[model samples]
Target: MSKERSSRILHGFISACLVAAVAAFIILAIPDHLGRAGIGAGSATKKNFPSAKNLSSIVDLEKEKQAAEVKIENPSGQLAYFKPEQVPIPPGQDAQAQDLTLTDPNQSPDVAGGSGAAVDDSSFGNAVPIEPEPTETFQGVPDNFVPVAEDTPRGSSITLVTYPRSSLAIHEPPAHVLRRSKKEYSWIFTPPELEKDVAFWKAIYSRYDKNQVVLHHPIYLDIIYDVVDLGYIEGDMRLSELEKQHKKEKLIEEKRERIVSILEMLAQNQRLSSSLNDEEWRIKKLFDNVGDPKKFQRAAEEFGVRAQIGQRDKFIAGLKYSGRYLGEIERIYEESGMPRELSRLIFVESMFNLKAKSSVGASGIWQFMPQTGKLYLRMNKIVDERNDPIAATHASIKLLRHNYNELGTWPLAINAYNAGRGRLKQAVQTLGTKDIAKIVKNFKHRAYGFASRNFFPEYLAALEVAENPEKYFGPISYDDPLRFEMVRTAYHISLPSVAGVSGIPLEELLELNPGFSSKVISGDQLIPIAYPIKVPEGKGSIFIAAAARAPKSQRGSIRHVVAPNETVNSIAWMYGIDPTRIRQANANIRRNPSKGEIIVIPFD
Candidate 1:
């Protein structure tokens, strides 16, 4: 057979098989199509299938392809052939709900909000809803503040009270109140005013940096009062002495002038003709220009002027105490709404010395004046709470709060603390601005000394020195903080009595209780009733119990025998007692008690 004819016969046989397969596939697809259309039970028709006429109709293959592409792009719209019974339920979430019987909706109880599956509550109970735990909100503390403990008494919420800068004058604290309130009130300094203050006081603080002056003495500039140096003169000579010195210097000058005139006359007459060498002429000129020794003899002594910086090693040693209180002081400052940076002011105020005192009568680590101390602290005959580190810190923070509220800026408020808010207000008012630069330049008062102008700058310097002590100062170490626990007494008691009860030495007890006045230590006064006394840490309960059992006779009493010079005030001063109390105690006796009269000193 020819190869072409055999190939033609094979192609015809293959065409017949393809036709038979296409017919079989169409016949099988009809049942599936009918079942999907919900017509499976009794429906079967050749008309339902694609007919020859439908296949002959013109169809755009490209359009069909585009439709397919659209369907593929929107997969969510694609039909899913899933049976309701086939879905897998989460295990344990209705474990017994295996049978999903379909029934009339009206016949079942509404299960929308109900427990589950319309089950009988008597057999399968409802799941109890869990109540969410409550959340507590803390105010005034920084987000990053890590409270030491959950139960510590320290973390009560503090609300921040803000005052507008313009309203400062309206809230101006009285001059006397500002003066004696808190010494650090005067010690407070903010950043903006600090720039100008640094410029003004940099020369003084630089003395410490330069090693020429290890001590920096800053006097308040009294910018707030428009009084330079607060009417304080470190040293001033009597007018008479100054006049006498002037006369003596004048006489010496006349004598020198007369000699010079005579010499000139001699030279003009050629009578003073000489062949004097350069050395001889220089000596002669020196004698002519020399002032009288007696006239200048008392110059240095006149004002008692002397460099304040001394004992560089000792100053650094004093700062060692600062390390012990740093953590505690900074914490209090933060809690009190004070900028923690100002805690370094303690280095300037007392060098962290809890027993520190100023010549002008500021006392304690915070250097509060007695008058100011009395306002915030117990500064009576028995107790001077200003000396207590913890008590003084709280007072100082309150003072800072006042300053910030009134002055509206930490810098201005801090200056108000040191220089007096009334004075600062005046400076702000007179300058018509709160700008530190303008106030520094335009504000002038005899009372405003270098200290007031440079307080914040000095504080900044101290902060700088403290922050990097190793860089500025040499190697340094600090004492361990004097850890203590406080206990309150129900009745008046002597510190010595407390010392006796605690089995601690009297000196150590006194050291721990710096708040107690000297009279209390001397047994002339008693610890204030219901006052808190500090004991070594973990010993408050022991001390309280022991103190309660202390002898009543040794607790406290005052008795004085009138001396030759013992007036009520004089007697009061001797024992650190109030004169009124002395007078009241001796009401039957004359105001001027006779010598040898015995008087009872009352404690109220």
Candidate 2:
């Protein structure tokens, strides 16, 4: 063969071998590729069957997505759901998306995309932004934001939100806000005429302490003669309480006499004198508003220096104590259609002193005398409702309501609470005006004294002080409001038995049921049937159960039939009980029990 032909053959043969090797390589690579594909398929199946931990995480994510759903009530009253993230939050509130609810009942299901579905659209309409309101204090929704509504799309539902009236901010208009309409408390308007009197009392409550005595005119409370410091008398540990009081009175009397003498001298002079001392000049300056010279004599005789004990400390303490019942008191007043502010009168009457009693028999925080108390409260040997803060509060509301109905003005009515309604009516008729300022300034009667004249002013002062206690007393940790559950007694039960069964402390029971007399507390008298008793909060059911399980011997009063020779003392001696208790138990019991007559023996 030729050399070229041999080379061509070798090349052809090598090419053939190379082609065979390429074919073999292709055939071997196909299986490896198939094995890799099978491994990838196995990996895909493993992914489909996730680990338990991963499955749990997926479930949690789904739950979070569901929680973020906002429920919107449609016009048909069916609930529609949409993700909260779909709605834009108001600018300043930093409100949580979940907290936002599309509350507009007129909303259509399509607004939420569909019932129980997420929203699809990013843009609904131009959202009307709500202007934030300024608030002093509130607890519910942020006062800043009102409900925002979007303009409805022609073919689509608009996102609308409407807040309930109670959820709306109670915005107190700024001083610049136009006072065009009367408010609910329009009747409680402070007359410009009595502003000075109100200011004077406000000062007494917030500015001065008990050891200070303010000497001012009876009519014009703004008039300042002097403020005598009785701190020395009070702080004298060497003196007894009676001696300190006597010394303080003597000092006050001396100061009044000196003031009266100065007034008399000023009246006699009838003109300003350069020879007047610094003290005299100061006194003269307070009367600059009084143009007449003869008025000085009237000031001496009619408007003599009246000393007022400062009550700043007492007022602060009262503000703290008032928290205990102020909520309930306000609720009662509001329910009875009376201004809640009227409850602040207790600050003036007794400084929220539950056991306060006057020399003339006025009692309780309301200062209700026995005569007036009897009209609304139960006052007897067994129970004196006057001592109960809640009962007295109710009684006071009734009395105040009656006074308002009769007197026709809140000021006059409130004054009538201190002074008699008859006297206030007489003043209104005599003065021929319903204006409290006119009555307070001009009315003159034997019964209408300085306290009666200033009662309304004091009330206004107390109301202002109480409402803004932080402004006057700074940050105070007020006592928590009284929390209790009321349960009525099924039987005539003794307090010990109730305490024993209910598992409540005896002292707590006594404190809660203050209407119970000493006799009742001591087991000499029994709480009447169906009498409501206050127990600790969440203990009403427990108390009821305990009361039901009370033994018969511990439940009610014991009774005895009078024999032929059974005298009251003899019967009492036989039962080992007090005759007074027997008399108290039986209202119509005579000195000697008649034969065959039943007598209720007071027992625990």
**Number of the predicted model whose lDDT against the real structure is largest:** 2
Backbone clashes for every candidate come to 29, 0
lDDT of 2: 0.64
Q: Write the per-residue lDDT of candidate 1 for residues 1-604, one digit (tens) a residue.
A: 5999999999999999999999988878777688776666655422343221111122232443233211111121211111122222222334334222111111111111112221111111111112211222111222222212122121111111111111111232422244444454444334454554453333333323222321111221111111112011213344465665455445444544443443344334443326555533432343233254421222222311123332234346556765555555555565455656666667667766777888898998888876666446554455566787666777777777787788877777766767888888888988888876566556888666555765666666665555545554656666665455444443345566656544556776777777777777887555533344555544443344434444431223345556553455544433334566667767776756776777765533
The C-alpha RMSD in Å for every predicted model, in order, reads 34.0, 24.6
lDDT of 1: 0.47
Off by over 4 Å in 2: 1-183, 270-272, 489-491, 496-506, 537-553, 556-604
Clashes of 1: 29
Worst 10 residues of 1 by lDDT: 101-110
| Cα-based lDDT at residue 555, candidate 1 | 24
Give lDDT: candidate 1, residue 419: 83
Residues 1-604 of candidate 2: C-alpha lDDT, one tens digit per residue:
6999999999999999999999998877665666555553434232242322111122232343354435667553334443333333322223442143344322212111112211111111111112212221112222122111111111111122221211001222311123434564665557899999999999999988999999989878889788999998899999999999999999999999999999998888855689899988888788889777678899998768888989999988887776677666665566566766687789999998887999998888888887777566555435666788777887788788889888877887899998989999999899899888899889999899888999998888887776666778787666666655444433455677646644567788777677777766876555543345666654444454444434321333556666654566545433334567788888988876677777676544
**Cα-based lDDT for every prediction:** 0.47, 0.64
